[model samples]
Target: MREHRGVPPILTVVAILVLGLTLSATAPAAVAAPTGKPGDVVRSTEITDRPEARMASAARVFDVTYLSADPRGRLVEVKGSVSLPKKAPGPGGWRILAWNHSTMGLGDSCTITDSLGKDKRGSRDKWLGQWLRDDYVIAATEYQGIGGPGVHAYLDGPVAGKNTLDMVRAARTVVKKYVGTDTSNAFVSFGGSQGGHASMWSNSLAKSYAPELKNAATIAHSVPTGLSDYFAAIRPGFPNVVVPDYVTYFSYVLAGLKVSRPDIDVDSYLTPLGRTVIKNAQRLCYAESGPATKGLTVGQLVSRPLADGPLLPALRQYTRLPTSGYGAPILLQQGYLDVVAFTPLTGQFVSRLRSNGVNVTYRTYPTQLHGLSTAQTLEAVKWANTRTTWPR
Candidate 1:
């Protein structure tokens, strides 16, 4: 196996990183304490660089480490910033607002801009900070690969869930400095695009994965996931959307599949184009993803049915809804104007959840595109405050 480098040694850095910190030493590794659920723990920490000056406006932002319960042992470190107002939300305790960033590291990458702020939009929009400031403790994550080591898991389900869930736990454990509350207070999650998918996975798994969480809220704006649905949607016409970038998603799925089914050959699934995309995806940015997507067509990539191989079966488990509904209330915000995630698909999924007897609140926003919907974003935060007392 070729050495896929980039992941930092998280376990090695935990002790030196958390020293003199508010959190006590990590309870123990791979062993769940009698806290709440299967993978619950007292707390954990990580070493990350200090935030840039722009981040200071938010009460405090810190880099922290957390564990990946995935059998793959992927690194799940992230950078999170939190602002706790004078009063916490629910029961006069602490309430947390965890923003799973679109593509940037957990910090508000949306805030960066040129002089006129012409290109300040997209995933880096700064509205997140302003929107979240007075409400609760806002924590954004960078996921596993952005700052630390190994390739970023991207939209890979288990890997994304691992980082998202761990970051939630780590944020609650560390944010006591700004907002004093037990890890159990009101905890809400929100993200759009890939972020929305992350929120859904986190909310779904919180019951079994991190039972300490009280409320799990998800706001999805044009979630470009569901590999099967995505592959099917972009086929025949939108070649560039599916072919060039479809492989980008496939690579993560391949790596994730490698952990469980080693026999599956990742290279076999890739064409000459697919291999090049994976090798260069790290260096490519938002600007590049657009131009790179040009000229490619979906028909070119769907040469054969992806279901013929093990990858499709693996992806089924990856994109499927959660096994059991969340113990906490769930709020799903979808943008009707979103072309990426598409309104039809999101609507279908929401209807299915309702049929399955899930406790859910669905809000659809018109005029909102494939990014964060203001209605959904505000609702998730307000819901979070009501659910927990962490910020109080």
Candidate 2:
């Protein structure tokens, strides 16, 4: 109902991007860590902290470390959490409800799991608990960075999708190998803000990437689509304050590309200030990243227009959400007043999906709806429940 642009607007719009997210580079292999399959449990330990336990409610909670791959298919360790039901599953067995978080930051210090114990994360805990009460296994990925290695590929839906699906894979293994329980292969990807963007790619890639798992539905709320368009929206010497602080997302997108798409030579497109800002962005959390980039417009961030460089093509290929190829039902929750994701762009995305024969259910909210909307959450849950592939 309110708008907050001081933070995450890209994955969170990067608008109050709001989620404690991070994607990183290779986890220091020098540091001793467990080893296993991509989805196998590298580590799984239950949370015993009083506050964190309260979040678990009746569900069993486990902090887990697992492996995922980058766009280049390089092995990367990703951190996530899994919550299991205390009671038995329904006749169809336990289904997976994977949570792809919004952007928090892109550094080791900004890890979401580590911050989960804080008092501020209560709502997220509640959200996870709701899924637990629904009798679903909850898998929340901290993306590819933080507890493991690699940068949290900000706004890179393909990488986000890979991390999300792999987290589901890791969750399945954590529940089975550690708790001695097996979950069904069915799942639904749910996310808001940056996570919303991630959910779309996670579900879209399910058929091709995680073919073993069946995605019944995908819920993307306040998702940033048509990323290429967004990249092009900003021009140099543009009036200040014309855009909200979310303009910092340009630094994030470029910071991510600096590592993920090194071929683009991200530095080549940026001025000295741009490179320095991006370098700082790579290590700073979302909150800090914004302030660090204060007063800088998108135009100031780059030496030339994005269209003048190879960045646009890379952004289109790596970041943009596709409208077609959704095998499962898709739900899009948009806020009319959300300048971050822009309702008009989302409308176009919805139209493309429907035109492509995707089962699309698009809803509108009056505000940005960055944080959880009880009405929205319950409705999305209900919609997802009706669409899950329980029989499969």
Per-prediction CA RMSD (Å):
10.2, 10.8
Which number leads on TM-score? Answer: 2
Error of 1 at 100 (Å): 0.9
Q: How well is each residue in 60-90 modelled by candidate 2, as lDDT tens digits?
A: 6778887887656766777888767767866
TM-score for each predicted model, relative to the true structure: 0.69, 0.85
Computed on alpha carbons, the lDDT of every model, listed in order, comes to 0.53, 0.75
Candidate 1 residue-pair clash tally: 27
- Compute the lDDT of residue 146 as modeled in candidate 2: 60
Poorest lDDT segment (10 consecutive residues) of candidate 1: 107-116
Top candidate (lDDT): 2
Stretches of model 1 off by over 4 angstroms after superposition: 1-57, 70-93, 104-127, 130-132, 177-184, 232-263, 298-303, 373-376, 383-392
